[model samples]
Target: MDQTRIGTFIAVLRKEKGLTQKELAEQIGISDKTVSKWETGNGMPDIAYLSPLCEVLDINVNELLSGEKLPSEEYLGKAEENMKHLMQENQNNKNAGRWQGLVGIALLAVAVFLTFGLSQAKIGWYVDCPSIILIVCICAACVLFSGCRTKYEVVHFLRKTVLPAGLVVMVIMVPALLHSLSDPAAIGPNIAVMVLTLLYAAVAYLVLYVAETRMERRRKQN
Candidate 1:
């Protein structure tokens, strides 16, 4: 709906409010680059940011979406239309996420089934190689399909996934580590890999926790 026009209107509103891009971004808990993108029509603000963005710009949602101020008589009708559109978009996104989750689960189930069948058939590398490929494929599919729409949602997803992801990493690597230690030639490299992987996973969890905590603090402050 005239994204360029809306962007220009956002810039105008920001200027009218006597706020710099960085200042507005700080108030809204986003980066200056993100604010610039919104003002330049390179991207739209996330739906989660819409309310705070409108607040900081001293405008209402209808005015923001319409790319201009509206008279009192037109306000209700325009706002209603915008709200309907927003609700539909939200519903579509939710449905897409549900489908993605289901597909991911199905892929994992298929991978498990195939691995079991191959192993039972007494195949050597056939079981090992295809299982690895299937696992990798499932991971790629999940990464592509399970994208979050906003920074907060990303942080939330990370927080929820960190424990399970860390556990999975350890479960896969620990056994390999033990197996490697049994081989004299591979001891040094295996130890190094195991240590590094564990350290990296720990650091990832720590960073995610800190970031999520900070976001929570900011939300409470606001």
Candidate 2:
């Protein structure tokens, strides 16, 4: 879908209807900046606002989505095209989400390692370090990947066996990491930690996934 074309079409139609950005936004129950964002191709209208926007612009949903005025004959074709674009966009977003899940686990491993592994050193007190950043990154990534908004939900998801399993791996890996870090010729030093962490992570995730699926099934039966 050509966002710029759609934005321009929206701007032109608004003007043709003798409405300013603010007037159009007021009619559609959105802020002027939101309308401006659409007009500038910086954002698209929310799905909730699409119907209202179509009404105000005197256009059909297909036309608005297609970013062009359509003849009666081309309307169905445009609708199909728009549907394909939406599906492809959805697939891309889900793929990006998978990447977030991967990163979150990797960061979780690093955070657990550095947070505890560094204790073996001569440091007296724990201060700010890269591990803090790792934790923060993983926390933010978890919210995005898991869609867990509430604190309780996030905590519940993290405090399950998945985290404990990771911690166990990290603890066991620490002695190996310490020894390897000291050896100049240690082949692929951190590989064991990363592999064990990822292995445990995969197992934990599979267990949690099966548990959730069963719970969902039980809910449906009840």
Structure candidate 2, residue pairs in collision: none
Each model's C-alpha lDDT?
Answer: 0.71, 0.71
Cα lDDT tens digits, model 1, 12-92, are 999989999999999999999998998899887776788899998888878898889999999999888887876776677
What does candidate 2's lDDT look like per residue over 34-149, in tens digits?
Answer: 99999999887766687899998899888998999999899888999998987787677558757967897898789868877875643323332333344345545666788887
lDDT of 1: 0.71
Model 1 residue runs over 4 Å out of place are 119-222
- Single out the weakest 10-residue window by summed lDDT for candidate 2: 122-131
